[model samples]
Every structure is written in C-alpha cells, then in structure tokens.
Target chain A: MKEERKKIILILLISIFMLSFCLLPVIYMVIISLSKNPDFLSAEKTLRFTLKNYFDVLSVRSLHFTDYLKNSIAVSTISAALSVFIAALAAYSITRLNLPGKVILLFFVLVVSMFPQISLVGWLFKLMAELGWINTYPALILPYIGWILPLSLWILVSYFSQLPKELDKQALIDGCSRWQILFKVLFPVALPGLFSTFLLAFIFAFNEFMFALMLTADHKARTIPVGIALFQGLHGEIPWGNIMSAATIATLPVIILTIVFQKRIVQGLTRGAVKG
Target chain B: MLPKGTEKSKELIEAYSFISPLLLFILLFIFVPVVGTIVTSWFKATTFLSEKFIFFENYRLLFKDVNFWQSAQFTFLFILVSVPIELFLGILFALVLNCTIPLRGLLRVCVLIPWAIPAAISARIWELIYNYNYGLLNFLFMKLGIIPKPINWLGTSLGAFFSLIIADVWKTTSFVAIILLAGLQVIPEELYAQAQVDRADFLQRFYRVTLPLLKPAIIVVLLFRTIDALRVFDLIYVITSGGPGGTTTSLSLYAYKYFVGGDFGYGSALSVILFLIAFFMSIVYVKLAGFSKEIA
Candidate 1:
C-alpha cells in the first residue's frame, strides 16, 4: 500500500510538471494577447484585459491577417486532400495489386521524405519563377502535395495492409473494376484512416515554413506561420499585442483538431513512425 | 481466381497507373529539384550575374568560409545538445503518460498541443517569453529572486544558443514522447508481472525489461530527432534570427542567406552539404533499424 501510494504521488508530480512545461508558453501567449499592454509581467505594469488586440488583428486591413489565414486554409486543405487521395491510390496498389519492388518503393519514399527542405528550395524557387507561378496557391500547393505524400502513403499503407484480402476478393467477385473496388470498397472501410491521414497532412502543410517562405512573396500566398513570424509594427517597435493575437488565432484550428481527434492523430503518428 | 497471363499483364498495367500520379509528383517536385540543386551547385547561378559553369568552385569557397564553419558547428552542437535532452524528457513524459494515471486523456491532449502547433508560431511565443524587460522569464526570475537583473536571452551568443535549445525542446519533446509512448505501449504486461513475481522493484523492472524492450524505439526517436534537428531553421529563424554576431545560424539558415542574396551557387552547395549529412544519418538509421526486415 505504501509503495503504491508513493508511485501514485510520483506519477502525479510528473504529470503536473509535464502539464506546466507544455502549457506555460501557450498560456503566456494567451495572457499577453488579452492584456492591454504586453508588458504586464514587468513590475511597472499591471494586467489590463482587453479584446482590442484581437479586434485589430482581425479588422486592420493593412496587417493583412485575414488574407494570410484564408490562404493557409485553402492551400492546406487542397494539398492535404490531394495528397491523401494520391497516397490512398498508391497504397491500394502496393497493398492490393501486384506492384513489383513494393519494399524498395516504400524505402525510397521514406528516404525522399527525409530530404531536407532547404536542399530542394533553391531549384524550386527558380522553377516556380520560370513557370510564373510564384506567389500563387499552386506554388505552395504543388510542393506540399509532394512533401506530404510519403507520410500519408506510409500511414495509409499500414492501415490498408491490416485489412483482410477477402474484402478485395469479395469486391472483385462482385465484378467491380480496380478503380471501383478502391473508391467504392476500400475507401469506405478506410474512412477513419483516411481522415487521420488528412488531418496529419493538413497540419504538416499548414505548419510548413521554408517552402512557404521562399515561394510566397506576400499575403497573396503567405501562410500563418510566415505571417506571424514576419508580423511587424508600422513604427520601429515590435507589436507584441497584435502578433500574439494573430498567433492565438492561428493556433486555434490545430489545437481544436488535436484535442478532438487526439486518438486518431496518435494512431496515425505511430503508424507512420513506428511499425509496432 | 488467379488471372491468366494477359489478365496478369493488365493488372500490372493498372497497378502502375495507380501509383503513377504519386511517382510523378515526387519525381517532379522532390527528385528533380534535389538534382537541380546539385547541378546548380556546380555553376555560377545567380540573379544579377549571368549564369556560368564553375564546377567545384562554390564548394571550394565553402570550405574556406568562416561563417559557413560557424553555422555548421552550431548546427552540430544544436543536434547534440537538444536531441538527448528531448529524448530524456520525452521518455519521462511517455512513462508518466503510459501509466494508469487519472486524466490521461487530458494529459495527452496537453502534450500534443505543443507538437501540433507550428514551430514558427511557438517560437514567436518563446521570443516574447525570453524578452528582457517585460518577458515572462525575466519577470518570474526577478519575482523569485533567481537573478538580480534580466539576462539578455537573445542578445548574446551563449544566451541565444540556450534559448533556441529550450524552445526547440519545448516544441519537439512531445513528438519524442509520443513515439516513445508507442514503444512503451507495446511492452507486454506479462513481462512486468513476471518481473514483479521475481521480487523486482519499479526501477529494476524498468532497467531489466523496459530499457531493453524500448531500445529500438529510442534509436528511432534519436535518428528522427537528429535529422530534424540538423535542419533547424524555423525556430531559430523566428526567435533569434541567428543573432549575436551569427552565433546561432544553422546550416539551413546559412544556406538560406546565400540564396536570399542571389548566390544560388553557394547556397545550393551549402544545402547539398546539409543534405549529405542528413542523408548519411538516414542511411545509418535505416541500417540500424533494419527496416528491410520489418518491411519484408
């Protein structure tokens, strides 16, 4: 009983530490966003709550916060949906069809995923410039599809492999073509896997920085990460209140997705990174 | 039913078509660009200057550049310092998380929040927290009497390095934890029960059973974190911008500077070097993990 009590206390203490460690910066961001002055933590200042920061971040036209947010959502959505679809088809081929060198293809894709983004950005910049696609949605979206495809492929392949071959055989006996069997049969059964893959891919695409930084020149294609990173004041000083509010707004979608689909996200992550 | 030869050929054609779109995207965007970067590195590619062939010149110049060496050193040190700490904290969190604790779901959601949000955004928060005058660190330290004055977190070489490390660890430890937790979950309960029956204590069971079982997962996290850390651009780019006389400039940021300056030749060379380092690490990881056997 004493040992069990000690163990419980230890776990509780670690849990508290973990919570505070993970949450303090986020909490500070929210508090600063709400405060009238970002210097509220200093001795000379006191906390004065206000919604004006959020108001300005949303309404101020010059800041172009809304434009960046909209672009991020659209680009991430398209990229995630497209990549997940492509990955699903490829996964179906690898898992169901008689694809040669399946292991080699998977391993090659894994290595491709590990290639540093910087190594690709220089030529991509020149290529986009040549194609006159810089500062457009396609500039970001196309690379994002390629960038996110490997993980999506890996996760879906694992998920699809678990499923019984009888399902495919049954659909084949029902006179469905390969495409129909995939779209009509496999997709419905793999909806949860597909959804989680989409979620992770969306987060990956949305959180992307280097490519978005290089490819997008302005709010026309700039995502939230780049926007928040480059948020500045009209004058010489840093506008902490506005930046924090923008960050808070930026983090909401991902946070909500994380909290609500926590289990699905965990499952997808492990499946991608660990075979077990 | 098994297909006849003609039908088998048709099935093969269909499978190739299914995977073609993926192959096309990856080849065009990832493979071709990496090749382009390598080819460009052997030239004098720049915006203002006319493009010219200058094989090995950019790399030769890189070998003699002081800033390049500084950034390369910083990148290596960052990986060495950060990956281990992240792994340690991650294991602790994973162990706590894996236990039958109350509010486990909430704890997990909290942990995932850090990993979920963009590192660039989180670095902005860290930048504010490290502020000298009104930043949370200064305020808290002063209140607790931990220091007599505010430390310039991002204004000095050592200070900026540690600041980036702390922020990177905060953003990534959750990722490491989650991966390690997956490893922890797979450990059979029967082994622990047997250990307990043999008069083992908690720490003893961990050392004898858990550590050995978790080795592969630990190695996976190690290599993953190392490769990710090797390309440490976003956090440092946001927080310090490699300040204090370029003390914290990562290899990626260094290469980015050259690119921004229209020195694509040198920039591509720098990136190629980073790519090779990461490539070498991934090769080591693949061999160590024995992924071939797993996939087979």
Candidate 2:
C-alpha cells in the first residue's frame, strides 16, 4: 500500500513539473507584456501592471501592426485554401483511381516536403526579382503553396483511403460519372479531413519566417513573424513592451485555432506518419 | 464491377487531369529552384560581369572558410545534445500522459500550446525569460541563493548557445511528446499484461516490451527532429541573430549572410552542403524504418 501511494505521489509531482515547464515561458510573456515598466529587467522591486503597452503598440503608426496582421491572414489563408484545393484533387486521384506510379508519386511528395526553405530561398529571391514580383502576394503565396501541398496531400490521401469504398460503388451504380462522384460523393464525405488539412497548412504558412523574411521588403507585404522580429528601434534601442505586446497578439489566433482543432490535427498527423 | 479496357483508359486520363495543376506548380517552383541551386553553385557570377562557370571553385573556397566550419560544428553539436534530451523528456511525458493521471486532458492541451505558437514568438518570450536583472530567472536564482550576480544570457558565447538550446527544447519537446504519445497509445496492453504476469516491474516492462514496440515512432521522431535541428535558423535569428561575435551562427544563418551579401555562388555551395546532409539523414531514416517497400 505504501509503495502504491508513493508511486501516485511521484506521478503527481512529475505531472505538475511538466505542466509548469510547458506553460511558464508563455505566462511570463503575458506578464511582461502587461507590466507597466517598458524595461522588464528594471522593474523587479515594485512591479506595476497596466494596459498602456497594448495601447502603445496598437497605436504606433510606424509599427504597422494591423498591416502585418492583414498580410499574414491574406497569405496564410490563400495559400492554405489553394494548397488544400490542389491537394484534394491529387489525393482523390491517388487514393481512389487506379493510377500507375502512385506509390512513387507519394514517395516523391514525401521527399520534396523535407527540403529546407534555405535550400530554395536564394534562387527564389533571384527569380522573384527577375519577374518583378518581389514584395507581392504571389511572391510568398506561390512558394508557400508548393511547400505545403505535399503534406496536405499526404493527410488527405490517408483520409480518403480510410473512407469506405462502398459509397463509391453505390454512387457509380446510380449513374454518377467520375467527376460527379468525386465532387458530389467523396468531397462531401472528406470534408472533416479537408478542414483539418486546411488548418494544418494554414498554421505552417502562418508560422513560416525565412521565406517571408527573404521575399518581403516592406510593410505592404511583410508577414507577422518577420514584422515582429524586426520591430525594433531606428536608432537601436529595443522596445520590449511593444515587442511583447505584438508577439502576444500575433500568437493569439494560432493558439485558438490549434486548441479548437487539436483532435483533427493529431489524427491527420498520425494517419500520415504512422502508416508510412 | 471492374472496369473494362476502354473504361480504364478513360479513368487514367481523368486522374491525370486531376493531378496536373499541382504537378505543374511543383515543377516550376520547387523542382526548378532545387535544380537551380545545384547549377548556380558552379558559377561565380555578378550582375556587372558576364557569368562564368568555374567548376568546383565555390566548393573549394567554402572548404577554407572558418565560419563555415564553426557553424557546421555547432549545428552538429546542437543536434547531438538537444535531440537526445528531447527524446528522453518526451518519452517521460508520454509515459505519464499515457497513464491514468488527473487533469490529463488539460495537460495535453497545455503541452501543445508551446508548439502551436510561432517559433519567432516563442523565441521572443524566452529572450525576456533569459533577461539578466529584472528577469524571472535571475530573480528566482537570487531568492534561492544560487548565484550573487545576474548572468547575461545572450551576451556571451557559451551562455548564448545554451540559451538557444534551452529555448528550443522548451518549444519543441512537446512536439516530440505528442508524437511519442500517439505511439504509446497504439501499444497493445496485452504485452504489458504478459510482462506483469511474469513478475516484471515497470522499468523492466518498459525496457523489454515498450522500447521494442516503440521503435518506428522513435526512429521517425529522431529523423524529423535531427533534420530540423540541423537547419536551425529562425530561433537564432530572432533571439541572438547569431551574435556575441558570431559564436552561435548556424549553417543556414551563415548561408543567409552570403546570399544577402550577393555572393550567390558561395551561398549556393553552402546550401548544397546542407542539402546533402539532409538527404543523407533521410536515407538513413527511411532505411531504418524499412519504408522503401512502401514506395517500391
């Protein structure tokens, strides 16, 4: 009985430790963002809390906080939607149709997805510059779609494979053509899978920084992560309050979406990885 | 119900039509740039001069570059130190979360939060956490009598490296745990039951049964994390910018410097080396996991 009790106590303690480790840095960010002092390190003795930092960051004209947010949304949303759309067609073909070289196609997608953005960013910059598309939405969107489509395809393929084939047979017997069966039958059935894949792609594009940093030159096209990282002084004095506040706001949408769709994302992740 | 010959040909055409859009985009964007990196590495070209292809010269120059060696060494060191630590912590958390714990759902949700936030944002939070004077770390250390003077976390060589590692571990260990947890959940209870019947303890069961069963997941996570650690860029860029006299500059950051400085040939050579490392690691991972059959 004593040993069992001890085991339980140990488990509880470890759980508490892990929980705190996962959460403390984020909590500290929130605290520092709200703290009255602009310099977080100097305000230890009598800490004051206020929302002035939030107001200051949101109101700054040069920071372009809203512009960063708008651009981030536009880039992530369009790329995610396009990647998912393209991936859905490919995935349906790979999973349902009897196509030659299907296995090689899946393997190719897997391999391509692993290429680091650094490997491609140089040529990408030169190409974009040549095309006069630098700092444009397509500058980021095209690469983002190319990079994210493979993973999205993998997830949707795994999902579409698991769906029962009886539904396809029934639709075919009812005189549905191939396109009609895909659009009217499989697409609706795979909606949940599509939603989850879209969310994952959106998160990946939203968090992408290297490409965003290299391609975007101005506030008109800069995404949130790069914007926040470069949100320092013209004369070299770091603005801790504004930086923290911007980070907090920037991270909010991603966190909410993740928590809300955590189950679907996990399912998609495992279905793609474990089977392969 | 199987289609005859003519119908099968029609279906193949339809499938090709469905896939063509993605195929065209990937070829133009991904495959072209990939080939361009390799092809551009041979030439030392500038906008002012007509391009000249000098074979192996760029690679020869990179072989003599000191910054290249330092960044490569540190990138390898980072993978060596952080991946094992993350794997250990991840398994422990996965074990606990897999058990019947109170507030299990809440803990799972909380753990995923760190990974959900953008890497840049997480680095920002950790930068403040490692602050010297009014930072929480120093305050806690002082209260506990661990040290008298505050440490400048990102201002020194060793301090900056460890700070980057700690920040990375904090943000990414949860991802390892989530993947391992999925592995743990799929493990059959029958094996553990049999071990218990044979009078095996928890540690013994873990060693004898759990480890063997969890090999595939472990291999996959290791591959993903190591490749990711080798290409460490965003965290360093945001937190330290590979500072303190470039003590913490990673391979990617080094390449970025040359690329931005318009030394395209040298930068392409560096990128090519990084690509080779990534390629080697993926081959090893797929071989270990016996994934070739799935493709063939």
Give the backbone clash total of model 2.
1
Please give the DockQ score of every candidate, comma-separated: 0.81, 0.63
lDDT string, candidate 1, B119-197, tens digits:
9999999999999989999888888999999988899899999999999999999999999999999999999999989
The reply for model 2, stretches above 4 Å from the true place, is A38-44, B1-3, B47-49, B292-296
Interface RMSD, candidates in the order listed: 1.2, 2.0
Instruction: Show the lowest summed lDDT stretch of 10 residues, model 2 chain B.
Output: B287-296
Question: Best candidate per TM-score, number?
Answer: 1
Query: Which pairs in model 2 have colliding backbones?
Result: A41-B134
lDDT of 1 at A216: 92
lDDT of 2 at B189: 91
**What does candidate 2's lDDT look like per residue over A1-276, in tens digits?**
665688788789889889899988888788778888745455345667998878977887777888898999999999999999999999888877887888778777777777777889999999999999999899999999999988898888878888998998899889998889989999898899999999989999999999999999989999999998888866786777778888888888888887888888777776556555
* Candidate No. with top lDDT: 1
lDDT of 1 at B17: 98
User: How much is B92 displaced in model 2, in angstroms?
Assistant: 1.0
lDDT by residue for model 2 (B138-172), tens: 77777788978788878998989999999899888
Task: Give the DockQ-based CAPRI class for model 2.
Answer: medium
Please report, in order, the local distance difference test score of every candidate based on alpha carbons: 0.93, 0.85
**Model 1: how large is the Cα RMSD against the reference?**
1.2
